[model samples]
Target: MVDFTFNAKEQEIIREIRREGLVLRKYARYYDEHEEELPPDEFPEAKEFAHIDKMAADRGADATSPTAFYMCMLMHRTWGDMMRMKVPFTALGNASVTAAGTDEQKKRWAKTRLSMANTEPGCGSDSKAIETTAELDGDEWVLNGEKIFVTTGIRAEGSVIWATIDKSAGRGGIKAFVVMKGTPGFELVKKEKKMGIRSSDTAAFVLKNCRVPKENLLGMDPTVKKGGGGFKGLMKTFNLTRPGVAAMGIGNIMACQEFVAEEMAKEGVAVDYEAGQHKRSAIQQKMIELEAELEAATLCTLRAGWLADKGKPNNLEASVSKQKGGDISRRGAQLALEILGAMGSTHDQLVEKWFRDARITDIYEGTGEIQRLVIARELLNYTSKDLT
Candidate 1:
């Protein structure tokens, strides 16, 4: 019951995923070079692959739960291209709705492509400093503020914006509002030129007296409690999402590791686990260390997901996973480049692209510094006020 090994059916699915990944790998470089071009929804080879339903139907009755298997698939699938295939059109706001919205709100917005806006010109990781304001106006809530670095803002049907009703109340007054695209005063300011993950659309937004129905307020809670109930509720979504972010990083790192290992093997520099660390060459020892770190980060990520699947609180574990995953990704990419020498920096290879992509892992979804702060406060039994 506690086994981590993939069964026959899961292995089959993974094989299928790998088969498809090979095709997607062909376009990775093209998209990386032409950041404005979007990948096609369906490739020529897409028809040959089994759909999700078919894959599910193929599962053996005695097979272990697919959660861990799926996580592994995520890593393998992304390994080919250093990016997740954007097949499903879900967004971060979808998770927010699932986590905090009322039943009616969930039913209405769950399927909509929704981006999340949290960062502002002045605030990035310090979300509590968000200056966006929301005022209740008879039948609607008028919002006014500028949000920067809104992922998918250009393409999403709407956005889940974090704005405060009472800035004086601190976190307690902060709330999420579902502002649909084409809202009169909500404007797409411009797309951001990012260092990596260029294929993914990142845009800035200007909300000037943008009004949405009062019912659009997430959880439909207007009260700003002293305990910061609204803010806490919104943050609960991150307990699961942080681990997902870590998984993305792990996937990208795994891609770099696999690429390096393959290239090294061709040069007769294969990793030898049978040899002692002292007996192995410097390169071999470094590879072994990197592999160990990768395993540690992977295990931490899986533990966080497992806890969440079991309906257990994973706030601390999620932070741990994110911190480990982000650091590993950044370092792993650098090590990969070092191993490949100047060849790694060439655009002809994916190593450089991965290196650029990995840099964002430590910066987004809360920076590595922020994650450490969370872990420290949790471990020391200190509140945000006590530590920060």
Candidate 2:
């Protein structure tokens, strides 16, 4: 029930990003018409905060609320949708450095944004089931396997890959590594033509005997005989990034609400705008519910981010927020599309794209099913090893 009070500066920042969103929307249409118009990188101011250490410190020092930091990142990413395919990789890379990388690793990757190409073919949702192998060879680790559905894999300056060091040990055996671009055996094998968020790149990577250094190991925890370290570190990254994904869902919901409201207005629908009186249009009613749900989900996301920033555990809340946000996003988009009728199906209207974009929210970060599983696991006092 808590509301975020955006001061004048924050309000201006939000308005600027929304205005920028309009520009990105135009470019999205351009990309739809001419695929080549999509660029590998379209620089945005968000890149300036790509360094997690400083950004984290600044947030802490300024006594800025976690809600503000999350909001800033959300706005930055949303505006970066001008080059969606590129920004995701940058964000992923930035996240990896903060969550898993060593001080040295962080410094080295500080300047360049990297993408996480973790999921692979047949891997489904189990990151521990990854087939990518990283075998120690003298001073270096040799990696070999194919990574599928890597967001930004095609154009990443570098990648943080989650692969198994020992398949026999299962999930615990997984480890993450920082793989720089142009590593001899690391190649972008394919890029998926996505249904929505077309501007964002989704790619597959083929690592054939790719050599990465021992120094590239990310987890601060030392590997144990019980297969510790890797997946735990990856989960930390997820805890932080998943909320950002949820925020994206919230953004999609906001877009849907806006579309639905406009459509209702065009039809000469009128509803009370008073503080206590609820709106009456079917679509408007749905929007109101979605907005309330989004507000709650947004709070969860901000709390998760706050916990992460404070180094507190928040597995349950994070999953709940993601699940709620993703579900609301899909529903809000569906409602918007239904209100728009046939026009919703057309590419000319952004509602169709919003619906498509909302679907990805449910699938990525963690599937709604996966989020439920995680929530239940946490509620039941289950450990990572128990479910995996």
Query: Which candidate should be chosen as best, given TM-score against the real structure?
Result: 1
What's the alpha carbon RMSD for model 2? Answer: 4.0
Candidate 1 per-residue lDDT over residues 241-271, each given as its tens digit: 7877777788888888888899999999998
Report the number of clashing residue pairs per model. Answer: 0, 2
Model 2: per-residue Cα lDDT over 127-199, one tens digit each: 7678999888988989999888877666667888888888898877887888988889998877778777776
Residue pairs in steric clash, candidate 1?
Answer: none
What's the true lDDT of residue 275 in model 2? 41
lDDT (Cα atoms) of all candidates against the true structure: 0.84, 0.71
Quick one: best lDDT, which candidate?
1
Question: Model 2 scores what on Cα lDDT?
Answer: 0.71
Residue 320 CA displacement from its true place in model 1, Å:
0.8
Q: In model 2, which regions exceed 4 Å deviation?
A: 1-3, 33-37, 43-63, 72-89, 220-222, 225-227, 273-281, 384-388
